[model samples]
Target: MHVVEAPITITGQESRPQIRVAPPGPADRRIIDEDALYMATTTKASPVAARMARGTVVLSEDGNVFLDFTSGVGVTNTGHSHPAVVKAIQEQAAKFLHFAGTDFYYDVQSSLAKELAHAVPGTFAKKTFYTNSGTESNEAAIKIVKWSTRRPLLLAFTHAFHGRTQGTLALSSSKAVHKERFFPSMPGAFAVPYPNPYRNPFNIDGYDEPEALSDAVLSLVEDLLDAAAPASEVGAFFVEPIQGEGGYVIPPKGFFAKLKKILDGHGILMVADEVQTGFGRTGKMFAMEHFGVQPQLTTMAKAMGSGVPIGACVFDAKLDFAVSGAHSNTYGGNPIACAAGLATLRVMREEKLVERSQKMGDVLHKELEALQTEFPRIGDVRGLGLMQATEFVKDAKKTPDKDTRDRVIHEAFLRGLLLLPCGKSSIRYIPPLVVTADQIRGAMDVLRASLKAAAT
Candidate 1:
């Protein structure tokens, strides 16, 4: 895949983005104090503060340049401020920017919807409902599932992170921290074991033997439906093709295929939450394509708008509700966001970024695997395409070592690379699809050095 390099020019830009000044730099300290005084204390800060970003680099307020492996939490797959995306935003901003799609019809929204319908897998006629975030998309999907099946129960998997909204939060089982105080969650949501070969729920072992583990996970789903929700009462089964925030855990090869069969048997719909795994992050347009299973409804966000706030739920025509006012959002299909989405999809196809991600992922996987062999702390390295993670453990026995992983991330940050930790002790390397091999190598070298420092 050949990518045409776009020229970048930043006015009044400083030299390098990575050289941090001394601790408590006046500018950094002032902003941190202001944030502590006013902002919510929800997120854990990583010291560096982002002032600007381009390609795979984030420039911090303290004049530090960090190689961004998080990709703004997988929302910048095309890279930060890609010329194409910026041009689209600028062009759209010049014209009509935010016309409510519901109040008035817009070409950009309609065209983007058509593109998404076609891009998603399955030959069946599809329709789309746009939203502002992954959680909103999942919320729309939940409403669609209930309206289509007239069922109230939703089945999700353990260790799944759908979103933080009420609807998606009910379906999410990622961690207690995200849900501890917020619950009195939406009712009738049940969880089944997801296929994790590393910490196999069935006590089975080996990644090579994923088929049997998949079967065990499927059996638990069957039992859950039988005991938790009756066939007539279940609405949909929601799953992430490759679990994102719960760790970049990829299930067995036949997991989705067999799970689809079980859902079919119970006449339940399958909803694929491709929020983080969609848009070429998983080597394919949608992760479910890897397993050869087409979902009844698919929710996507993350890279859909190339860092802009846009998300959508694409579903089979059969699931379109007949009655009006079943589900709606004021900012569902903003024109500006649609323009961004259109530009993102066009850039991805024209540049063949999906294939680039696949090739680069192979390189990344090899490097991480080499590190795993050299560093005993890295217990597992797993991923699909660019969506990969390295799980750290005290030993091969698979005990989560959050302290070591956190230290590694901090060390990498200090050395000019940015990494994000997910699950318990796993570091996910989700760089932009536009990331070059050289950039990947640079980031991996930082990771290697950080692991060594953390291990010592």
Candidate 2:
């Protein structure tokens, strides 16, 4: 209905996508041109103008529907515009909009906070600090750890992306462009290696020797604490259970537990940036659950509000700022956002989306690994649950082949399957949990077709 020339429709359960014409056609250009003319330059992956979406199907402005594998960059875990979430948004909008819940009392805000505290993995008494996005959640975590531990230095991993804010940005070292003009990031932020199974500083193949990779990284952390960043001065060790922007890199099996043990000995706290991996993206409720370690602070945001702008820093109650005004935001618990959050939680529970993520993730992973076997360019296929990716390589040495990856993305787009890229030369396939086995197979088939087209 969005485009007169295009009558194509796609759904979350099937891959029967039809594209009468390539995207960025006449119908997509008016808005795309206007956005280019007026909008600030951001990470605009493609010009597929999305008019509306339902479940995993994105109806573009041109009426060219796409099988959305990006999940709106992992924010819509329950699928796009679920009827329950939309109804909650509608009902809440009718009641009241803004009430500064940070200063005043609100039942919905408190209820959602309690739900998050219970939902996030941790046995200790936890509290939630609401924010509008993942960066702010991480920002609150940074402030809390510093205030609680009173340490000047923070530890993070190389190729780690916390956020774009100054404090979280200081902790982020994933890409040089993120901090290009930003000079002298927050001081005393120590950087180190993550236990990447594919490639690492030690040149150990992580797939073959995961334990060794973990041990070498652990040894370096200890040396850093003893040397440049003294344990007495480090506040917390900030980590991603699964690196998001850096790559869909999964740390070795016991890496986080071992790191937690070391940090525990040094009087340091662990902060898991679950902004991207939270809300059942990685088969578990949170990726930290995958590691079996409870972080003192867990920063979450992406899927918490199911498309609404909401985020929370759920930390152990012991770390709550001693004073109220130490860190507060104006719209921490906006009423409508809370309603959407509550609805998202219910949808996940009633629909059993977390279990679906695990089941569908197994299917996706198997298919991707199969693609790896078929395509020599696929250097590595790695991830947990629906959060998956394939790294492109020039040869067996695994030199990044970004051109091929980008071309494949463009080719897939033309064929009606939308995807997002990650790391140096990889495409991440993070379809919503609601996606079906048939949809997964169809998407992979499209991927194979695009791969062949890109190769030529």
Candidate 3:
């Protein structure tokens, strides 16, 4: 498989880290200062201002050319400004930007919707609902399930990061800060323990006995059905095939299969939130494909449009809204975004990025496992394909080391390797599928140096 040498040859995306004047230089500081004053306080991972990027290379405002492993929080899977995606966007924008698909008809929106319906998991007839982001896609799923099943309750995993929208936020349990001031989220959502192999509540050594971990979690799920949130009342299970923000935690093998058996028996819909894990991030088109369970509904965004800011909730066609006006978005399926999405799909297939993710993911895991062997502070290294993470822990007991994690991230930024933090003390390494094995090695080298610097 041919890996992209650089995101773009003419655009000057650095193949490796090059810290010229250190971070927060005059230009970076200027943008940071303006942003602090004007922008609302949100999740700001690093102070480095992105001037431009291509593939896995990011050119910061400070003129520091950095290797980007974050993929803009798992959005740019086709690589930064992929030529095909760029051309499609330009061509579409030249024609028209937004015609409001809900009110009007457009071939771009319908074409992309058809593609999404096909790309998403499930052999059963499917339909697509376009939205603007991950949260909105999930919000659509929430409506679909509740409206279809007429069930008052929804099931979500503990430590799952669904979204910030009030409806999706009901299912989000990653951080209290996300829901601290916001009281009374869309009600009737019950949280269940996710079968996180590394740090589950049961303290089972899942790496040694994955089935045992699955059994323990499945027991609780059964209990939930038997007791409070009964299966009859639960409309759907909002699950991330591989938990992203809650840490790149992959559930134990056989867990999903068991859980799906139970959900099927109860006739509860399974909605896989592929927002972060979709579009070859997990070496598969959708992470749920790895588990071999076909969810009735799938929510996707992030990498779908190759950074064009689009999302979709593909559901069983039978669950489509009976009323025409029940759910509709103003700018959804915008021509530019849809065109970008179409181009992204083409690029993924034409470039064989999914296969590359599988191949390079082996290389990434090997390097990470090797690195884990060197660093005792690294409690766990888990993930699939290019979407992987290392949890920083204090000891064998696996206490989360947030301070150490933050320090490592900061050090990495200084060294010109941009990364993002997930869960409490885990740093996610999700380079675009276009990322080469050499880029992974270079990023790992920066991580090794960052880990060493943070140990001080």
Please give each candidate's TM-score: 0.94, 0.97, 0.96
lDDT of 1 by residue, 269-379 (tens): 999999999999989989899999999999999899999999999999899989777777788899889989999999999999999999989989998998888998899
> 271-295 in candidate 3: lDDT tens per residue?
9999999999999999999999999
Residues 5-68 of candidate 2 have per-residue lDDT tens digits of 5455545455655675678777788898998999999999978888778888888877776889
Give the deviation of candidate 2 from the true structure as CA RMSD: 2.2
lDDT of 2 at 441: 86
Instruction: Indicate which candidate wins on TM-score.
Output: 2
Better of 2 and 3 by TM-score: 2
Q: Against the unseen true structure, what C-alpha lDDT does each candidate score?
A: 0.86, 0.91, 0.89
Q: Whose lDDT is higher: candidate 1's or candidate 3's?
A: 3
lDDT-best of 1 and 2: 2
- Order of candidate numbers by TM-score, starting with the best: 2, 3, 1
Candidate 2 wrong stretches, greater than 4 Å: 1-14, 204-208
Best candidate per lDDT, number?
2
